[model samples]
Structures are given as structure tokens and as C-alpha cells.
Target: MEFDYTMTTIKPFDVAVLAVEEEIVKAGMRVLYVHDVQKSLVEKGFQRDQFKIVEFCNAKYANEFLNADIKIGLCMPCKINVYVKDGEAFISGMRPIVLSQFFPHADLGEMPKEIDQIIRNIIDNAK
Candidate 1:
């Protein structure tokens, strides 16, 4: 029943962020941009740990998957939340397969599985 996957690392939050980014690139994807959710929370008068979101994508994967069904574009650019908790850094995100099921295009060959595996591997390696 588990859908999202998360990994904890003794490394600091910034280090964990770099780890996730490195894994994504090693898999041949590009890290789109990082968002600091913690900063926004702090602006709201709430102190929080490092809570950033890292998004990445692979052009080759996207082109092929869209050929199968462009609707999959809605889920383009996989995202992972890089955060700190209890002095430990953690990366968490939904498995692409979990979201793919929402659309009928979930069974479009191995493309979905390919994307899922890449992102999952990124999270795992980040740990």
C-alpha cells in the first residue's frame, strides 16, 4: 500500500540536496530548479527545518512517453522534497507509477516504469 518513498541521511540538509541532484544527473536527467518551502514558511512567522523541493526531468524519456500519450505530460518533471528533521536530512516524493495510475495511459509500455525507476533510484541513491 505504500506509494511515496522517502530516505533519511545523516548528512546535513544541503548535503542531502546535492546528493539527490547528483543521482538525478547520473541517471541522465536535469535538475530543473530547487524551491525553498521553508523560506516561505518562515516568512509566515513559522520556523521550520530545511524543506526544499528538487525537480528534475529527462528529455529523451519525456519525448518517447508523450508519443505514447501526451496526457502524461501533466506529471512531467519528477519532484522530491529535500528536508531536515531531527538533525538528519531526508528526501521524499511520490513514485511516478503511483501518479501514472490516475491516468489511463499508465500502461504505455515500459516508459512509465522507466521513469519510475529512475526517480526511485535517485531517492535511494540520495540516501
Candidate 2:
């Protein structure tokens, strides 16, 4: 699951985020919450309409991962964000596997690969 698509010019960040969402949905997971960052920011006095954070979780994945290591919970219930900048829509998110790099003892080597694939697929399908 290298998630390296050389044929397309889509930003890896956006693709990865969208891929995760699509994969989770295809896996029969439910969206627990969608925080509209643009609206929230506006309400908070930020003048912008190009930010959003999508929170999703698969119960089975979460449970299994948590049982494997509780510390991983800090990055659980993954989030993907959609935002606009310089006339382009950009997607951003935190890759759990990348985060795992900070903690070598955490066994997320296998899980991050799966997650990366999901994210790639999402980006591939984005219009």
C-alpha cells in the first residue's frame, strides 16, 4: 500500500484523507461527527470559509488497535480536513502510521499500511 500514484497530480495530503474516509465507509463504518471548521472559525471570529474536519471511526478497527496499544488512542478516531487556499481545495490529515514513527515501541507498522491505502483510494476518487 505505497499510496504513491505517479500518474495523477492530486495532492497526496488530500488524497490520503479522502481515501481514509472512503475506505471506512466502504468497510461499513459510520461517521460520528463532521465539524465544519469554516463555520466554527467564522463563529470564533476567523474570516475564512475553507476549513473542515471530518471525524470517523470503525468500531472494530478502533477496538483492535486500542487493545493492541492504548497509547495509540491519542490518534484514534481519525480526522480528515477539507479546506480551500489560493483557489484550490486542499485536504489535510494526520497519518497514524506517520505519528507512530515517534513511538518506535508501538506496533502500528501493519495498520498504517492499510490506512494509507484507504486514504489513497479516497483521493483517487475525489472530483
Best of the candidates, lDDT: 1
Error of 2 at 15 (Å): 15
What is the RMSD, in Å, between candidate 2 and the native fold over all Cα? 5.1
Top of the candidates by TM-score:
1
Superposed by TM-score, candidate 2 places the C-alpha of residue 6 at a distance from the truth, in angstroms, of 14
What TM-score should be assigned to candidate 2? Answer: 0.73
- lDDT of candidates 1 onward, in order: 0.81, 0.62
At residue 64, candidate 1 shows an lDDT of 76
lDDT of 2 by residue, 100-123 (tens): 565577666577767755655554
